[model samples]
Target: MSQQPYAPRPQDPRPRGGTPPSGAPPYPRHRPPRPPATSDLRLLLRLTVASFVLAVLGGAVGLLAAPGQLTGVPVGPAFDTFVLVGSLVLGFGVTAGLYALVYFPLREQRQWAWILGIALASMALLSTLANAALLLVGPAGASPGLVTGALKAVVDVAWLVVAVRPGVRAALR
Candidate 1:
């Protein structure tokens, strides 16, 4: 068999002296796409704020439903203990919800929101666990104690899941 000779590389001629590729000065390339638009962000903010309000409302309802629970630290009931307890729940719920908002602007891709979301989720999980434990041990397994404990645990877990949702996180941001 005979080997073929190597051919020289050929250059294509430009059509009618058109602008040469890479000949023109480089134009500014756009920076990485700015995150989602402000309108979308506004929606998220609204959702986050609404969720926080809902949580506060839920706490108020819970307090109304049961008046004696929600004990503060130091093993003592301050003035208007029921109101104080309810207020605490509302405050905590609102704070947790608002905590989720900090990351909403970047909710679609924000790492901080993820961190905060995880923290909030952990809080919910902990609340559930503590409530479950209380139900098991408080008042030697009183019916109301068990019920309330279990109920609170369920609510916390549910809220945790909601807070961790991508859409929710984004909205809060």
Candidate 2:
């Protein structure tokens, strides 16, 4: 006896990347159907995931740059904690979070997302370069932050190269 392949029931929850029913509400973005992420796009996504690690490290770096000492003023523990928290929220944490935002629309073939991604990558490359340069030019020996910053700059450069790939640009367009 031959068995038939099973079909999904009408009420089944739609799987990701699956088409919606004809009568479903239209999306606001008005984007055309896009192909699955290109390898370069996938690489970009991976970089965003990696950025979270950088964000945490960035927060630690804030402790090293404590505001109390830099400003030459006495401060309470509460303020010190506040500064570190602010560092995490305002610095790489936000930058990394925004990268994920760019990923979704870029995967959906949004031109604006593509543009934003390019801008984001360029800024990241510049920031990491500056951070690494500061550490290298300082009197202090190579520290963990320096090594990590240098590596992050390398990754940012690679991300920018992938972001400009013909296939990646075409998909977003």
Candidate 3:
């Protein structure tokens, strides 16, 4: 009987590059290719961070604007109290939403980020629209408000578009 010569086993760390090293066992034919790692999540990250900061600032502003003195008002005590409570509620809600929707989800790369971001953007757009309408229709001297609202609406629209892109979705996933 004749004995065959021994050959060293080949080692290939990356099998996705096609073809295993010589002398290595044949690679599995049915293995699916892995999705490539996304390399462009900077915009999303920046948006998330900015949203967080804005949420905090908004909450602070709401708290500060809670109307401590109700002087010469036509509304009753209940209405004034309601206004205070509503402002506090809205402020805290915005802060919480930003944390839950944008900050945490973005950090974890969760799909909730997309949904929450869209909701946030839509809300922002609507709020800006309302502001613009008020500025245009309200008494006089609101040009600054109109300009700010328009700018905010534009930013909101941009955020909505970027958040819904296929690349952003893939990256989040």
Candidate 4:
């Protein structure tokens, strides 16, 4: 076989500096596609509203169910005053706090909202469990207590799940 010298391929007409041709973009332009709008935010809002409503209802029920005197405690001037005033204040204060501290700020996507929400949901879950326990062990009671406890448990669990969801956390951010 005869030996032959290698030949160089033809060079591109473009400049050697890696710059694009005149009037062309300096670099290829690429943008990542935008993420789809999350519907979880709307669901979170609806769930929050429902929770607010439930809190209000529970407050009303607490006031209505308030006993005239504290039971299983010694009857005295100081004890009576504490029982009467303390219960009312603590009950309503917690409900109001949940609204002001958690629900309102949550609408504005505050970072603390989920923290407070988790606490609130935990408290609610505990309360629901207590109510269910009372209903189960106390007596053959009316259906409302059981129904309300069940609903509250479900709502609280849903709140906890939604609060930790990736979409919900991103929406808050």
List the candidate numbers ranked by lDDT, top first.
4, 2, 3, 1
Tell me the whole-model lDDT of each prediction, alpha carbons only: 0.54, 0.68, 0.63, 0.70
| Reference-based lDDT, residue 20, model 4 | 78
lDDT of 3 by residue, 1-173 (tens): 33634433256364454677688778557645534435435576666565555545544543444334455476898987787779778877756766566757665666677787778778877876776676578646555555545555666676777777777767665
Candidate 4 per-residue C-alpha lDDT over 1-173 given as tens digits, one digit per residue, 9 for 90 to 100: 33634433258656455667789888767855434435675677678777767766765554445444256666777888777778778877877777678777777776688787788789888987887787677645334556656776887888888878888777674
Best-to-worst TM-score order: 2, 4, 3, 1
- Candidate 2 lDDT over 1-173, as tens digits, reads 33734555567766445787687865547756766667877777677556546646654664564334444235877776677667656876566678667867766777798788778778877877776777678656547767667667677777777778887776665
Question: In lDDT terms, how accurate is model 4?
Answer: 0.70
Could you tell me which 10 consecutive residues in candidate 2 have the lowest summed lDDT? 65-74
**Residue 154, model 4: Cα distance from true site in angstroms:** 1.2
Please state the error at residue 21 of candidate 1 in Å: 28
Please report how far candidate 2 places residue 26 from its true position, in Å. Answer: 8.5
Could you tell me every candidate's TM-score relative to the true structure?
A: 0.41, 0.66, 0.54, 0.60
Among these predictions, the greatest TM-score belongs to 2
Candidate 2: clashing pairs of residues: none
Error of 4 at 21 (Å): 44
Winner on TM-score (1 vs 2): 2
The superposed Cα distance between candidate 1 and the true structure at residue 58, in angstroms, equals 5.5
